[model samples]
Target: MTETITFNDLGLSEGVLAGLRAVGYETPSPIQAATIPLLLEGRDVVGLAQTGTGKTAAFALPVLSNLDPYETKRPQALVLAPTRELAIQVCEAFEKYAAQLPNIRVLPIYGGSAYGPQLTALKRGVHIVVGTPGRIMDHLDKGTLDLSELRFLVLDEADEMLSMGFAEDIETILATTPEEKQVALFSATMPRQIKALTGQYLRNPKEVQVKSKTATAANITQRYLMVSYPQKLDALTRILEVENFEAMIVFARTKSETDTLAEKLRARGYAAAAINGDIAQNQREKTVNQLKDGSLDILVATDVAARGLDVERISHVVNYDLPTDVESYVHRIGRTGRAGRSGDAISFVTPRERWLLKAIEKHTRSTPAEMQLPSVDEVNATRLNRFDEGITNVLAEKEKISFFRDVVAHYVSENDVPELEVAAALAAMLHGEEPLLLEPEPVRPQRQSRDRDDRNSERGERSNRAGAARTNDRGDGQPMASYKIQVGKRHKVEPRMIVGALANEGGLRRADFGNISIRPDFSVVELPADLPQEVFDALAQTRISGKLIELAPDRGAPNRRTGERFQDRPARKPRRKD
Candidate 1:
């Protein structure tokens, strides 16, 4: 068994400590506490822990500590992840942890983005390269990414990479690396493929497994509110008006989103600040310190940037965007309810993201209570109650008020306004922009019966009947009308993506949609049969997966024969430089 340890006992350099302090990491997590020591001793390690258990740090700290800075940067450490999202996340963690280590650049290379920047960064010589297997292989083939000086090779989320069919690519890449390099592998599960890979590549690896625990703090009152994308801001504002939270942390998905949300919250008069990857380390530290000292009430942050943060004053954790994965959900909620304090975790789940919520519940083995959006009346009543309480507090304080009383009397006499009217005006001024509480939109849960049936149905029958069935009408007898959308297989969209986009952007429940037929260049969707022109127009304006959707009457043309086959489409024209 590995001995228990602390961050100080791990022998990390002062530069790493500075980075850790900037992020408020006072102690090591269980996984980090266990795995760092062996890895620091230059032993190959196989770590068994789920995401969000600080696995990144378990390997990152040791790698940074053992590296020789004076050595040429031909990629000393290489981390391979399955997806672009995971690759970026791991790179971000390394960057944040190694902030004070000058000349130790970390780069992430993935598809769905330009490769020029990645190539440039590689040519400049980065010490660590975290990337998806395909893109990394591309660089390796092109002679852009050099691993000649590599000392450590880490396979993060090994099971995920194998599931994504990167086994051959991983093997090929590992074959190119030097035999002297230390190998570390981490995975949530030890599947047969992962085990096989470990047996083939690892050298007497030290195994460290964190027992999966389904323990969530009893003090946390977890709840979730279902709302559409546009209504989310309004719903969140309403909740802020009603809930009496001391300090809160709002989690977003990206750096831009954090800033956008923070600005919106600030405009609404909340003491808010954003913390994301783009912010400088010193400024980020200052913001967190201010929040701890009660000067700032809310902090908006992304998951990677918020890692290692521990603040006792955070009374609530608001997931502004539902996490992309279960591990992220666990980490986001874990920000609150620390140090034996009771806290609240509130998530706003768009209809499309309900699946992710369910996944989180399955992984955490804890369900969040469903919460209804706060009504306008509820918010207004709470605001008035708070106002009254403030007045009471002011009155309770022993202070001579003769000067204020004289000034108010004079103003009332001079303006011929009632005392109540004067007080109301003052309250309005103090409240800033007149409080216009929004009416909460009615939330209808997505119907999962069809989805459940689809999952259980035989593949052959489901594909054959894809275009034949029609969804049941509501209380009315009219069958929903079928309309053709301009995007389909050519757009590389799946049924779930289409469903999620519609539910998120159009504010339509899953039940509102009927049979969906995906074809080469277009799709047919059953919308409300007698939908008003406004609804049709709204649907026309909707964009899904970043493609504008034009709605037209179904031509009764077989969806399969609508347009050019997806595989035969003309090559995309390259863009001109500005």
Candidate 2:
């Protein structure tokens, strides 16, 4: 193995070196070690490295080192990221590395943030400006950003910018910059577009290429939980209760989901916060600082919001929603298992998305081990241990609790209750009405009878858990309506797809849908017999596999005229059991 290179040996300015020491950063990463010297030498370079490869420092340190702090605060260096979160992260890094340097100001400008502050900062002057391509273009069009004196220009995550359809904006902003300014472009992959842009801008650039690793870090314990759509939130809370995580980042699919999940976690007494594009820059900065200082335990965020984020305390990463692509999946989990520390990554996969899970495995060349949810006993044990620890802590603070102990003693005497009983009452008060232990889902046995009468009886008893039901006086006395959908084995329709479509489009809970029986060209599903016409209409318009769902009343029996035997029908399969 090659010898590790220290930051001191990288020839960084004394001010930058002091800042690095203050943050406990000693050695440089491979990309940093290779690119810093080239950047300091004012070479236009192209760096190929994935997220979390210390790419930010590879460029930021050298740019800051060469900055003239006493010069007129017109922006001297420009860094453009793909997303607002990444721009903010990169800007913060510049600030950290330039902390000991006087008269240096770094500003981050991004969309969804108020323009008043950005305008003020621009008017007051800043040495460095880091922003997303679109926002940077906005500034350039308005003539608010001055790049005439810019000595360094960095394009971080160039590939991601193109993926987000910002190529035009990027090119427009690049065209506005001075031709003499030194430029650096960093990206995980060099696609044709990025290559074309580099060819157009960079002049005989030095290429520092770091091969992408397909597999996840070996130090990360990767696991997946197969769950239904409805039970995912509950399942996440159960895991959080039992797993001893120092800090965690929960990745969701949308900004609304991040807000909803964060709110739910906060109601459960967790120090949780939501970080998304909608949040103001100052608020987002404060939330990140809180996470770093041990004040926040959980961060609920979307992919764009959490990009390029690095927190040493993040011991766990939970994929609340799977990404649309395999590369995104790897990037999402990459938030953890960083800084040479062992971390855990757990993903919740619904049955409909199992194919996605398999694809991720194939792409990453590693299979995630299946994990069982914590048993009720395990959860109870964790709760009891926490209660015991609380008691122990209170006992340890004897002097602080002496007055409270006397008051409790007086209450016990006045109420003529034993001290143990009083203590039990106090414990009960501390633990709220919500059950301390979760109830395991009940298991159902397979139906055995195949006779005509038995088959009819079984169909009658099927429960419609998703919608309103009317009792069938003759059978199990449950309300359920059976409907036929135009999708089956021929269409490659799976039970999970039907369930996912209904739950997603009809605004119904997972439990609303009951039994599903797939046939050659059509499938039958049981739902609350009294479902609103609006919901049923919505379901009819929902598309699966590019085919609109055609739902109608089930003809009690599939035209027996065809003489198809009841026993010849394929057995029903549950998508997943909660």
Candidate 3:
């Protein structure tokens, strides 16, 4: 039997392995599997795949593996994404994968934010930096950012960057980097501009192309919802409130799931029914007739039972469970947009199944617009409008509601209450214990403050599943504070880099020259009095070779860096001779 390839088989650092487990990814995507080994072997790579492919992880993982953060704290790996959103996204991915390796630091730099923090983060020493081309250029021009020590460079979405007219900026940035560094360029299409770019910058690159057969449905409007399996019902219920779908077919994977989902939908008063392989032909036909006659609003069914089932009233198709193969997905959504009518297809994908989604998109040649789960407040507003419309619609039927009006008027008089009060009371009774407005969605604890450049408040709604959980962002309003760590070192690290991490963490000027000593096992240096606690914690947790550092107190120190009394480092000279 052929050996099954997995992430475990890939030569990854333990931290990367822990990250894969945390993010719930079991197998590598085609792009990742093909590109990882080559990049890890110090070969430049060219990846050709659509957006949803696992491109980010493919390069990010290997770069993280090869980095020696403690030995050299400056930005070693730089990734240039096309936009602020993608930069933030790629930065967050780096942070997540480097979670187990607390010593490594990552930052996102872009144009809109103030430059103070970006310069500060750079000074403090970062292992990886993800940013847009424009901002990176600004830093390079200002001499605030240095790429002299850069070991790896990645041009993510190279085609998009060029389309956005970052072609010149990309070339300038590429020219600044050392020629010895490994470079990777990923793009969906290779145009002449991109071809010329690869030829000029990339050195004998190994092309890793992942192509899928084209499948198109021009008439169908496709969208995808990123929700967990348990949260699907909540999402479906809220979607039903906002959608004006006349009839929908919800596809599930198995017979039991179809039956259970149908029962749940009916319990919510959706006029829903189920059809599966086990159902009798007579009952199936009856259900189909009811759907066609408008008695059924939704039909939940297994793929096997849904075959050859067509109804003109069907306006929507929902993939309750994603199909295992591309053909299956195409066939499921194909149920709608039939004949001469246009239709909608919504697929529910769990966060971890993003790779599968990308694969489906690449095969179908249709980019499904990402969807946000409706907010409780938004749903409540929708309900209120619907309720008001219901009453206004009823009130329009003057002849039909006269008896109900008389009953309500008599109740108001009997209870000695105003007509409005009577109406409110009646609405309360009709809704029973269920509140007309749903409680708001639970808020997660805030980690990093939103950056000034944040276009959206939350992550997922604006992101493509691979998004910002806690941005490695420092707010402008935050005092330009410094952070550092103290630990007993068990492994070898460059002494200058350690001091650089300390000096930058505390925002200490180059003149803060206190004598520093370097020892074999541990090192001691004077810390800035104004160093931030966050930086202190980070320094304390930072591990070199998976071992913690020993914190050394100043002047009348207990233990000292035994190597020698280090000389004061000079200040950096001002910029842009090139």
Instruction: Give the top-scoring candidate (TM-score).
Output: 1
lDDT of 2 by residue, 379-405 (tens): 889988998899999999979989989
Clashing pairs for predicted structure model 1, backbone only: 481-529
Better of 1 and 2 by lDDT: 2
Question: For candidate 3, what is the lDDT?
Answer: 0.74
Q: What's the candidate order when arranged by decreasing lDDT?
A: 2, 1, 3
Q: Residue by residue across 1-578, what tens digits does model 1's lDDT show?
A: 96656587887888888888776677797788889889888899999987667788888888887877766558899999865556777888888888888767888886545678987887777888898776677787778888888899999988866654567678988989999999999998999988888888889998999955645677888999989688889888888888889999999987899999999999988999999878888999999999999999999999878888899989999999887656667777888899998999999987656655765676687899999988877887887687789988877765656667788899999999999998888777877766544455567656458878678668634432433223346555545756677888877756765664455434466777777899888897877654445344445535444355666555443348665322323222112222
What is candidate 3's CA lDDT for residue 388?
Answer: 95
* Candidate 1 residue-wise lDDT at 345: 95
Query: How does candidate 2 score on lDDT?
Result: 0.79
Separately for all candidates shown, the number of backbone clashes (residues 3 or more apart, or on different chains) is 1, 5, 16
Per-candidate RMSD vs. true structure? 10.3, 14.0, 18.3
Instruction: State how far residue 491 of model 2 sits from its true place (Å).
Output: 37
Model 3: per-residue lDDT, tens digit, 308-416?
8879888899998886556568778888887879999999987435545776877687799999998888888999999999989988999999999899888877988
Top candidate on lDDT is: 2
**Alpha-carbon shift of residue 28 in model 3 (angstroms):** 0.8
User: What lDDT is reached at residue 578 by model 2?
Assistant: 26
Model 3 residue 417 CA deviation (Å) reads 9.8
